[model samples]
Target: MPLADAKQSDAPAKRERAHAGAVRVVAPARLHLGFLDLNGDLRRMFGSIGLAVDVPRTELVLKRSQTFKGEGPDHARALATLRKLADAYKLPAGYEVKVTSAIPAHAGLGSGTQMALAAGAALMTLEGIDHIPSRLGEMVNRGARSAIGMAAFEQGGFIVDGGRGELDRAPPILVRADFPPAWRALLVMDASTAGVHGEDETNAFAALPPLPADAAAHICRLVLMQLAPGLMEEDIAAFGDALTEIQKIVGNHFAGAQGGSPWTSPGVGRVVGALRAAGGVGIGQSSWGPTGFAFAPSQEIARRLYDSAIEVARREGLEILIAEGRNRGASVEKIANT
Candidate 1:
């Protein structure tokens, strides 16, 4: 898809393109800061914080169609649910949805959820449904519940989902704050190695030991006293320390269920250790398993960390990806006449 300005004037002599029904929706990728300790049956209900990143994304284009089948069966199911929701209130049907995303599959970026939501919103538009955006979250989650979907559909800063609740509850209230501009997150991932599957992933959560109150209290304090304030003040050092501490604590708690250790990715401990040795701070895993992220105050620091990690990987013959945090929102691609 090519980027274009809707504001551009169309040649008066050219025919104006038209479609029976069409809409486009862009959904951003997300990063989990830490796992929220949700109460039993609610699973991670304590409410974890998540932020959108620009690198990986999901885009959906919807138009009227008589038949549906192909590559994304999950997306198809999501569209069907949206169509049913539209019909419950007397709305149009038959939609063609094309989904595209940059977020890596099985990397814990919520790619499927984002695609589902983008498709859902576009389907609603194609069907001429005029419902509140608040309802979109729950509706989308019915098909994919990665919370990142709910968070991206809503916007700004950090977001948390309160679990199965009324649509009126909407997306959990977002706590807005700018991540320090100097901070760069180097995401080290392994594409060849697969992590836990979705259902097994859910089971992993189910198997987690109830978070001890002491640990939860400690995390709550760090969020309140250090993390939130540090970001607000743009205090990189303080923010890094708090984040690093929180990650260590949470990582330990999660280890019980994942066997051996609850690491974001393999060899993450080495990367975190190397980054720390190189004067980088704020390091941890995102969610579930197999992707590690660490913070550097500047490109200089990041390079140093990357160089060291590279040497280590070479010695062991491993592959890793290094990505930075995007201050802006998700990238959008508008399909032609979409």
Candidate 2:
């Protein structure tokens, strides 16, 4: 469903009015549009901008219980997250958690962070505990790096986080604005290839050279001058150009870690090239991705790009999805237990 239709169909106020036993929360997937500065002179690191997408989200249902139990995909991770949250908050010992729908893990789509927050939010709501995302994130051992996922979960849209410096808090949101309604993003992923994660991800960062000063300067300028302004004015072409430029700089910065090409998957470079050739714009990868995205000015254009790229993606065994930008954050509802 489109975001507006989804909102109307699952209105939280209406659902809450009929509350009985369970709390359900839906959190969007995020596209990490490269970090602002991986090598800042100050303690600040990984300032980021990202867009939240409606489909392929993390959905959870939770209810208070005597002993913690988890069901559905990634059940073990969900249970562990809940236990950590309970331990950190000194909350009650039990909650029954179910992951009804889960974002694909380690796809560079911010799945882990969103799942943690969804689990935290549902548990807190069921227990009648008041909590904000930052505290919830800290309890769940997230937001240690970038705040874009946490902030996007709380209030979706195109988000920019100022980065964590010396503070232990969530990175402050430097800006938040609704992505243009007419613009659509095509998310393409190679399911056969898993993105870098766990110890490997940590080591990749440790191994990466500091981002060149000139490149960092260029990124900062692009975001501040072109990207931010283009979004504000709903200028799709300008925004697309700025995004492409940023991706080129950041992609090259990590080329060594991801083999000679900036992309993690073998054919992703060709796919991106084909999409651009087909008139898709704003091409880029999300985080440590095998998943990549590009933008279109309208639904028709998005579909055309998707149709054109479907063959290329199929040849490479990629999964392609055309999704609209999620202007609002997550939706939490209280559902009656049957």
Candidate 3:
């Protein structure tokens, strides 16, 4: 990591200092470009696979509140949590939470998970709760099934959630790689279509084949032998190979659930093929997506691939987002003093 810091002013130089009345936080959106076997009692082999992208951010602003009421279950729960934290830490009495997000709903980007984690973080931090990234991730992940989102928000990078278990301590594993500064992740998402509904999602998995013991072992091999080593060395060739291997294994597993290859979305197969044809190194669909992603080596490669993908999708009259992998994550700014 570089020691020197470079600061660029986004606004003109100001002569005044403002008191902090609110805490602001930003959480990055994630792409589970690939999800493996379904979580079930019959199989101890299932795990979530994904990376955090630099698009569709979730931002939060927390300020002191006075006699505010929360209407929804999630909102009420959040308020209750914040109140408890405040009482425990001897902090302020009232607070307000304002959330702004660009991440689409149910596109498999982990948007909801990100928001939940960010809100939790803001609440905790404002109440003087001392926390490490991993601890904070664990705390927030309790509110949602997606632990990867909490991990991504805590430490920006490629990550995977180990998945919640009966033990209640599913930690995240951050991929060991220095994402190239020029690399960009473009998520081609279709918001018009809905993914597997929660009810259907559970039932779908229930009906799927139980994962064989060998299958989980094979996934572990892809992660350790290929993905882990390749990522650590920043070897695109190796990384691409590993991703391809995982895609095949995981894609096959999801097949039984969707009554097909489990590519989930009807339009993703063509895009994945198109991306590969356009010199894309690795490509896959996010969990139950109407969203597909293509990984390029560089910006030039990304542009070329994106163009090719757009052309191919045009034939089907389908639209997708062209996103880039971000080295650094989202940014949060304080817009007002109060």
Candidate 4:
């Protein structure tokens, strides 16, 4: 359907004009640093920390319609997300949604949650409705397990979330800060492999033993005492060291579910080790597996790490990407209908 002409008036017209056409949103991809606790005394579980990155973002273009129509490589998932929002909010069934740029799915890059939030935000914008991240996340059934993705989508940077207990709301953000601009993250991915997900993911969690009390306490200490302070002081080496330690702890905790190795893919450990040997620091896997990341304090060092690891990654059929930390969140815009 053709977009309704914006009414001519003063205040109301200005508001209408702002949302009279199509709504477009670009949501960032996030790297899951590690979970703080799986077993907690307060009934909370899986508190998490992560950082958003500018590349591999999910981009969507949406407009009101007489019937729901979805287009693009990720159209199926986008349509499902839109339907959930529509049903929950009693919104119209009609919408034309298009996924322009797609994030890599199931690579531990927060693709699913970002896409869902992007679609929901676009629909809300098309309707000229204002919303906070948690509400938008709820409308799309995201932030159920971890709030890091939702918070990153709302406002990029490093985010730490309190664990989810009995609360139906999105996990509260305990900390949020802009990651240092001089540091870069080197992402290594095995495109041929998929991480644990869906029913498999559910079963994996169920079969795993609870996190040990001691490990949880240690992780908390690293995050609070080392990682947080390092960021505050802009000390890359300190932050990187703490992050590496946290990754090792978390990786070992989940090793039972991810085979005998701490990393999901066999080559990940080798790649990480090589990066570290070449001066990269703060190395770890993102989420379930197959995507690994390391930090460098400067672009030159990042490039050096990538160059050194590319040969090893190629031997394992993996691809490497260099991304800087994103200090700002997603962007949404209204495009005038021609």
Candidate 5:
């Protein structure tokens, strides 16, 4: 096979191994749209819906090294993830995992989950172990609340997970649908702030009251009737409308955790507000977000909206990028002998 470089990893790659060679895994960044049913009235909680985007991805390489080390953004976390995978699978510890690029950490872009999965999958390839993305996710303690990251890692698209139940490791994919190729997701990012995380996140959940069953039911109806069908039919109005409403409901419920606001970063919230008036739709914050997103029907419209919101984004010290929906999942490929 030809030598694998950065370009080769861009294509859809299959998992493979070569003697003493390097393996690269590209994990996509995902947007956690909203939770469907957080109340657990149906004996399930945190059923979520999300979409995978093409830009802002995590890419990494793994090869046998005399010493165990990792390089690049979140490399420290990557090393820890590797250790977890090694212990769980009984694999050797001698490996160098280089993270070439990664999504912004704690930006509500699923960076942590993507990093864990990419690191684990790279190690799995090098060791010739079983290749299961969800298993890798479980090994790294991902998918505790939403399995959207795991699902996006394995199969990028619009994903809906059945939520956590009796199962321990993986959540069932309730719906997986392709997003319109022409549609765009404009990301509103803030580098200065971080969303609620770790112990704080846990505490926030504990402090919050349980969601009302009727509210959960409303969200379910929105997803099942509007979002899903709108996506399938490529009706941005219907889909974006549903998504916007869902975000409102989920945001209001979590507002107490976010200082009585739907957004974690007020700057991001401001920019998203401007973008909304600029013709962007499906506006919402991702996860416990300092990062927010809005959708447009086409790149042209997205760019136009982006331009219109540039001044507002600049004032808020935020960044904006246009991204298409990713229909394909993460890829793993082996490079020639290192």
Candidate 6:
């Protein structure tokens, strides 16, 4: 807890925006992309699309630590999410927290809902409290079933949400946009497999089997007529062909929990099919597998699909790069409390 910099003037404090005390937060590593109404018929379900990237981030910080702790890169899942929001908002759990950098945990990159909404938004600005990021992601369970990581921690762009509506909360932001900043993605990681999260992702959605209401109504008319008019007409081939036909219909219904193969890592699914055969066009796999993505339309076509998938992503261990879309969110500062 020693990070002082309101403007120390060396240009190192913008952990994505916001700076002042021992309360950092950062965030940004979304990209769920797919799941527009997982067939709840009309009662609502898991409508998504997400984006908010800018390369694997999470940050975290907090101050005053005599002991209630956590330390870096998944600090024990950020001290079990700061001991469940410090015992559900009783606050002050003797701060020490420091997840210096995260987002890799389960590989689908929502790293446990962005480390439980960046440890409940840095303990609500170190206990000033005043909730709202879905009520501090409901005291730390961080949006149970996609609100696009609590609206990408409060407003990064290109979202969509509007799903779980029977009153469980979390799914709401029906649209956000602005992701066409010269569009570019790539991603592709695979840090040695890790995606069917906790309790096997609730028993792979209770052993999946329902999605048919006319194929969830034709993937909701390809996200309202071809992915929101190819993201407001930037038109990366009509938004990569409506996000590769909604990731081939939600990766063939989660490909029998990914063993049937929507790719949990068949070498990052052959480097996302050589980054969509080197043209990279909104490929798939992001929220339940060895991280994959593609979508390129600038930055020189994502550096020619990262130099044509950098040697088949290093002969298939995988690691492609090039990200972009993070239209602002997550950044809560307040340093100098050492």
Best model per lDDT: 5
As for TM-score, the candidate ahead, 5 or 6, is 5
In order of appearance, the predictions have TM-scores of: 0.76, 0.91, 0.77, 0.92, 0.93, 0.34
Arrange candidates by lDDT, highest first: which order?
A: 5, 4, 2, 6, 3, 1
Off by over 4 Å in 5: 1-18
lDDT of 4 by residue, 93-163 (tens): 47888888888898899988899888878876776655677767765667777899988988899999998
Question: Candidate 5, clashing residue pairs?
Answer: none
2 or 4, which is superior by lDDT? 4
Question: Runs in model 1 with CA error above 4 Å?
Answer: 1-22, 36-44, 69-93, 131-134, 142-149, 160-171, 311-338
Please write out the lDDT profile of model 6 over residues 315-335, one tens digit for every residue. 776788788899988888777
lDDT tens digits, residues 1-338, model 1? 00132112222202222333466666666677775454334343545666665555666566656655323424664566555444443332355666653466667666656665566566545443443334655544432333544655556354545433434344354365555566666766666555565688789767877777777777767877887888778787887898888888888877775566757455765766666777777777777646677777776777777887877755544444544444454333334454
Off by over 4 Å in 3: 1-19, 33-44, 67-94, 132-146, 161-166, 172-176, 314-319, 326-338
Q: Write the per-residue lDDT of candidate 2 for residues 170-258, one digit (tens) a residue.
A: 78899899998988999988877777888888898888888877788888889999998998898888899999999998888888888
Candidate 4 residue-wise lDDT at 115:
90
Give the total clashing residue pairs for model 3.
Answer: 12
Local accuracy of candidate 3 as per-residue lDDT tens digits, 1-338 = 01011012111112111234566777777777454444455333345666766777766677666744433223544565555444444443567776544466667777656665666567555544444545544544342344556556665666655554555555445352445555555566665676675678778766767666566667667877877676667676787777777777777777776558656666677777788886776567677676777677677877887887887676666665656554454444444545
Window of ten residues with lowest summed lDDT in model 2? 1-10
lDDT of 1: 0.59
Q: Tally clashing residue pairs in candidate 6.
A: 7
Q: Which clashing pairs does model 6 show?
A: 20-334, 20-335, 21-334, 21-335, 22-334, 22-335, 282-295
Q: Please give the TM-score that candidate 4 achieves against the real structure.
A: 0.92
Model 2 TM-score is 0.91
Q: Candidate 2 clashing pairs?
A: 156-329
What's the count of clashing pairs in each model shown? Answer: 7, 1, 12, 1, 0, 7
